[model samples]
Target: MYLIEYLKSADSLTIQLSLTLLFVVVYIIVTKLTDRIIRRFGRKNEIALPRVVYTIKYFRFVLLVFILLLLGITWDISFEGLSVYFLSFFTVAGVGLFASWSILSNVTSAIILFFYFPYRIGDRIRIVDGDNSIEGIVFDLNMFSIVIKNEHGQKVTYPNNVALQKAIIMLK
Candidate 1:
């Protein structure tokens, strides 16, 4: 057919190289734009924009991978081949993500808590969830846990994720 003839006659290598170069240029421009935007907005706000920065970085990485795949396709690489390549990579990434889901979730919650100012160190806080109750002064806030010292002088450590989920009452 005419389509087959056109495909065979097309300069696939040239197309691939051009696309690769274009992708690189676009990526650089996007990164600069994102940095400028984040700086402009984030500076005006009281809280630091770690999540936004992380999201932009992740997006850039994904875009770079997409561009590379496009380059391969333009050079007459088959979709089946690409799928096989990405499948293994995705499988490994998925397993790692699954294994670390709890940690990641807790870290994300901690980031939100940091910006929200729900409770701070040295603040008296009462956490009541069903029959479990702990009234204490927050001593430390770390990545994994929040350390609190109760009236009985007992140091209690609650996982960050668990602390975020419960209702916290601040007392003067």
Candidate 2:
């Protein structure tokens, strides 16, 4: 009887705590699942462990932001306040980030290429961009760009974003 009375009296707080715990549990489970999938895919593709780890770190950041939003809602925090803060922050940061948005795109593309790109280092491939087509052996893959050495021994650095946008022909 006393426990029931206490629970009734603390209903709001109890519900809030329960929801927070649930969110944390769910977030943990999701993180583990994603990490497992990433590792499995990386192993299957022979991707470098460092690249897989970096991808997992990026995923964790996204998950953290989602968990924060979930907790905020559970606690009845004001969305308007968060929106205003983020608006101001992004507005100020956007200027600089926007100027170099291509860099960001390259990084994103690099992550995608890490897992799904069929061509690997030493693979001979051709990028079919009319008037700018490139045929080369992939020399290196970096976060920002792919370095390829052509038949003439000319080294070309192609941005990851552009690589993804262009059609690739696997010569070998």
Candidate 3:
């Protein structure tokens, strides 16, 4: 048949289109599976709504990065060419924003807190910092820091890194 002959002679655009569809299918399946796992784990652990939402967002961001990398490879984008572009951009970013590496550390801390942390929101906790100890109710936690409301009704923003490093006493 003419249709069979045409199919046997797939063009470059046809090949690219097929590959794109394959990648999209894989991405969707992986994303859905990961999302279900996160939600199930969150429910089992009784994680707060805000915490669960943020965790999902973080995971989706990672998946997006992976998909973009795959897209580049599928399109035959030159990594050698990209290396030159990224090298200069990263060099400048590294010099100007080197001090902000703590932000990444905080993000790592946030992930740790999301899973292994013992306390939940609304639990009263005291961080032992010698005489300058902080006693407050756990308020909110995000990508950067954990918020706490002290007894005097003041909100304290504690860096996630410090929160992880210090000793905490659960008051409630």
Candidate 4:
């Protein structure tokens, strides 16, 4: 009864507030539903990789951000006033990411190796490095480097980026 009367008498500001609340509720429901579905799929497939898990989280974040942006536009939040700040922030972020290129490349290679690498742990293999070809058993796989125990019993840790670039031979 009170709610009906309020809605009937709602001014422009009140109506706008109600719409904003509705959008937020919808966004929350969508984000939660998507997360639950992805969680179920991950559990069913036994997806334990950080790459896949992070991708899902990033996707949800991006979706929520897009929804928020839409809501901002709907409520007349001024992008013109914020554009310069966004540009400055991105420029700084670009430089930082560029400075960490090597680390980033190795991490990217690790993701590729996780999905497409054929060799298993304990497999004997040779990475064709010309004068310093490495022949060893695969000891361990890490996010940045792969560890192999060479013939002389010394463990060699090669960056994953290099591993992806070199040709590998399985010696069985």
Candidate 5:
């Protein structure tokens, strides 16, 4: 049969190599599609928000990790080996990133706010924080903080971490 002939034409290693290459190609196509989806999302929101950029980068990183795991599987690597490798890597990274955990928290909040934040640029809003609450029109938002133009025309940069903790009232 033609199928039997084709299978006999290549060694097992060669067939596996071909399949691995195909997997990489598919991974690349999926990564590009995610990028396009992120772009379209940003455009639809009418702002190429900083969180969108971060999301795309994070999405690619996660996908790369997945494909690398698949590659390891293709090469007959054990799951336990992969788990040990990732665990050790993240452990070292965690030690180094400990001091800057607050920064990391803010970045995480920014990602959440990107999808669910009720206010947009030019929207007047108030943050409830006891007597010291601030009211302003959102001017800009970046990974770390959000800039707001206050009643006195002062541009206030509020940390994203705190933004999530407070109650936000959108004003007309």
Candidate 6:
């Protein structure tokens, strides 16, 4: 009832909706163009398609955020108010990060692993730290850790941050 009353009085809502639809159409067009460019370049060089697709998706997400911000402004949402909201959000995020330092470290390491790709599935790896060593075949690479299968057929999981920090010997 309140939403209907607000919409009925606001001519800006129609303008916001039109702008949002236009943004979506333009976004689709731009994405299609990007896909063609990626395909053309990727075909010439043997670039991985999944990585290219992920990059495109990230770009699209940023573009969508910008479009949404524009829509909000068109609807007369106050930028000053948004700044306070974002500041509060960042403060909360910072507190959460401080509370979960180990988890954050693991996530950072996983992101690095994704780009560096020191080890892949089926590769034999030995992780050494001081006197301890774990040897196994790489099974999977997840967001927080790496999974492996040892000679005894036991599954082992190592947090990415710790695993990447130590000496890793790739046998294959």
Candidate ranking under lDDT, highest first, comes to 2, 3, 5, 4, 6, 1
TM-score of each: 0.52, 0.81, 0.83, 0.55, 0.75, 0.58
Write one digit per residue (lDDT tens) for candidate 3, span 1-172: 9756865798867867777888889888988998898888889988887777778888888988888898888788999999999999999888766868878788889888988888888899998988878899989877788889998999999888888999999995
Clashes of each: 0, 0, 0, 0, 0, 0
In model 4, the runs with Cα more than 4 Å from the true position are 1-82
- The TM-score of predicted model 3 comes to 0.83
Model 1 worst lDDT window (10 residues): 42-51
In terms of lDDT, model 2 sits at 0.89
For model 6, the local distance difference test gives: 0.76
Find the candidate with the highest TM-score and give its number: 3
Model 3 residue 36 CA deviation in Å: 1.8
lDDT by candidate, in order shown: 0.73, 0.89, 0.86, 0.79, 0.85, 0.76
Worst 10 residues of 5 by lDDT: 42-51
lDDT tens per residue, model 5, 45-158: 876556688878878888998888788878888878678988999898898789678788888888787767777889999989899788999998878888999999999988
Higher-ranked by TM-score: 1 or 4 = 4
RMSD of each: 6.6, 3.5, 3.8, 5.9, 3.5, 8.5
**Which pairs of residues collide in candidate 3?**
none
Model 2 stretches with alpha carbons more than 4 Å out: 1-10, 151-155
RMSD of 4: 5.9
Error of 5 at 154 (Å): 3.6
Q: How big is the positional error of residue 34 in model 2, measured in Å on the Cα after superposition?
A: 0.7
Please report how far candidate 6 places residue 106 from its true position, in Å.
Answer: 3.7
Error of 5 at 66 (Å): 1.6
